[model samples]
Target: MLTYQSSQDISITPTKGQDKPWLLLLLCCFWLIPGLVGHDPWKPDENVSMAIISYFMRHSDWTVASIAGVPQFSQAPLYFWVATLFVNALSWFGVAAHDAARLSTGFWMAVGLWGVGLAGRELFGRRNGRLSVVILLGCLGLPLWGHHISPAVVLLAGFAWYVYALALALKQPLRAGVLLACVFIVLLTGASWADALFAVLFAIFLFVFPQWRKFSYLITLITAILIAIPIAALWGYSLKANSSELFQTWWRYYAWGPFGGARSFAVGTSVGFLPTLLIWFAWPALPLAAWSVYLFRKELWQPHWQLLISALFFKSLFIMLATQQSEALVLPLLVPLVLLASGGVDELRRGAAAALNWFSLVTLGLAALVIWLIWIGLVTGMPLTLVDYFARFSPADVHWKGWGFVFALLVTLVWGRVLFRKQPLGRRALTNWTSGLTLVIGLLVGLFQTWIDVGKSYRPVAESLSAFMDGKHAQCIDVSTIAKDPTAALVYFTDLALDARPDNECLFVIRQTASKESATPEVLWSGHRLGDQKEIFSLYRR
Candidate 1:
């Protein structure tokens, strides 16, 4: 029912207002698919974050550990405060803290999805908006990250939406300055200091852009910085107390294993490094994207160029500077990519739609093949080499059985209908089939592999500690070895106070490597004894 002008006249135009509701509904469904799979309680980060929440709920103190009845600062307490509210609210209604944390994560993540939809609608027309929402929700990264209640993901999503809204306001002068100020504040609150430099850069970009008609650029810049003052003060205070140790730990993380020297330059190490390069050339949509940018060169030179360039630069720079890297961080930059890609798709004239259709088919086919191979590995009981490699260092077990079948079946059903049916499907049908299938696959893969099965490695250790503390409700004293993961997991699962001193009474130790002689503590539980290393849960009671 929709129509457009000739390819030469094609632009990234907005859709009719009448189409807004339908697009919104599709976007909502895109978010719902991932939400329905339920949250997994097994991720170490999730476990620790939830544990911290539970501690705040049960105790009056907000410390990560209590020493001699004195509270000591640990990580930033903002995330804990948010999690605590959810836990307490859920407990009042009779839900467990863990479930509360899970539900809260889903709720915030859905809010984040709404933010993404709003960003899409503002940057592109309703049709491109629908595509942006679909791509974001369907992407493997978003759904996986959504389930973990880390502030990093929440900040990423929120800051991205704020940036999008700020860009939109930049195009209109009357309210642009105020909106820009407010958005800058929100970005600071959402991401803490992590987003500070990026936010400042964006604010500068907005004020200096030629589109602003009234307010002086200098005045706008001063107002933006003024708005961010409270956030900066709070960040400084948090740093003075809790940030020093975290930076040291982070530095160690960067210097060591996963983030270490040579491996840091590997294919997936930087956020957009690989994907951008790959998509620019090899992706079917590449030509369309190139043509779109080419056609819109004049528009690109205008005020909007600031947004596009700032987003691309900041996203790349931040990821490269990070001690940790993952593809999910690139989600913020997808808006620009979608705009460029859509513009490119628009330039193909009469053959544009046909070309897109073919590209879509090929992409779907490759995705299906990848899914099939994964399923085969799962169902056949063959070791997934990548998973095995991870399991070697962490306390996780990989199961490939049901996951493969589920993915394969889902892919088959959706593609089967799309390929075989001659009748045109409605928007709901397309959104549901494509986005829904993708969501299912993402959740299953994330929950089963990343959280559940991988959690198996830590389960015995966590459970052993749990069992040892059963009914006694004893406060934990000290735990030996701080490898970020095992120590973090112990604190999370057991909600126990940790001590670094070996001389402390009532010590609990998780020895990663075996020793020739046993210590004073009785070994409470042991797991799958391998050669030099076996995860042992021991308790030294005074």
Candidate 2:
């Protein structure tokens, strides 16, 4: 039978020791990989979010809707307020709206990565922390979701860090109370019911766990409530004033309908391994995590495991329970998975006999394969069959090029060196090299795709619209058929105030057919044709 040693028996000192140079290299890579992927502002949700931020920035009235002109109470306004500050600050430096949005996304994403690394270091050792950073940087879904100015991903990242800090607080007294207070303040200001529910569950887990029934736990709990009250009140005021419709819509969506239908086991449970693999990339990690839980079930029965498990369960359950579900919702759950996977790594490291080492090698090899597949699909384009199906609707051609192939080869080679090197470098060195390579290569690919190629497509349209609005002194502009005409982009890019009653003022009608017989606004400006149609603008003085 296999025997295990207690935590006290194991040497606390890391095998590789401190590696500052490697840690810096890993951090740089973490920033670069996600930064390079470039921003794809495709979702309407993104546009809506930006508009909300713009409104708040321009009016300084969190309680009133000056831009979208509709009462908006779908969710809490704390994220919008924070994003608004960034937009307002950047505008003072003469940055354009789109650039501001991208910068904001990039900033939050970096913060999230930092939190991931810090949390990893605290829970696991330095080696596992470095490995966690690499895994997060290489995650495709994370970067993709980060591009949209959604609070969900950011909130998830922030909440995960808070939970990590909370765990530490349970162990330490005075310092823990302060950290716990901070966490409560942030969560309450965000006012996401999801966060609140998770916090309550976490408190209960601490209460039930034998190890956490200490004075510090009680102190932290009391401080958390005290810190939360004011923030919650502010959020409540904002909701009551600006977004009643949003609240109603959200409730209806989640309470009963298709969203509810999707959550049912019949649909959600059916989402098998393929979609999971595509989303997470490290598919085997899930099983490894489960195995680790079984191995360390006793440790998990204590407060630390209870905290991590409760956070994971509540986040997943809330998301799955939602009427509206998307792949993005699962991104938050990845944090706990990363922590659990680190535990698996720890188990493997502790039992580093020949068999376990071979298993680690195989796991790393599988991870490399997934990374290569992602690089090929993202940079070079998909197979001919996939291209044929998807290319028809896409704005650009779908074809693999030689440069992308070369880039992929380079990445594979670098990864191969890190993995297959005969002279066994310690875990720290391996993690640094792997993470650094991922960051540098990933950023290069992203910059080429986003800043050079894809960015060009929208720049001209945004520029022309901005110029037209400024030249004509058009304060009141109304857009029809916004989805096809890029009107929403124009509105956001120009920071133009949306007219609540466009029919009562001078209106700029986009995409309407011009006929001599028709009685409407005269043509003000027209530009580049998309597909078989040209984007036309008509100015009408009402």
- The candidate scoring highest on TM-score is 2
TM-scores, all candidates, are: 0.68, 0.69
Per-residue lDDT tens digits of candidate 2, residues 1-542?
Answer: 01123353244334454334464464444444443223434444665666666667667567533343444444456667667777678789887554566566666666666666666666664445555555565454565566556666556566666755665665555665666566566555553455565565666566666667777678877776676666566655555465676445434432222233113322244334334444444333454457668878877665545666767776666655554456655666777766665555444544442444454456555655665554456445566565454333334542355454455456555555555533223233334334443644453453234323343343455567667677654475665434432544555556554453344343554444433224434655555322213334434433
CA lDDT, candidate 2, residue 243: 66
Tell me the alpha-carbon RMSD of every candidate: 7.7, 7.4
Tell me model 2's lDDT, rounded to 2 decimals: 0.53
lDDT string for model 1 (342-417, tens) is 4334344555555545555566556656655654554454666844544455444434445543653654564455
* Cα-based RMSD of candidate 1: 7.7
Q: How close is candidate 2 to the true structure, as a TM-score?
A: 0.69
lDDT of 2 at 173: 54
**What C-alpha lDDT do the candidate models reach, one value each?**
0.50, 0.53
Local lDDT at 389 for model 1: 45
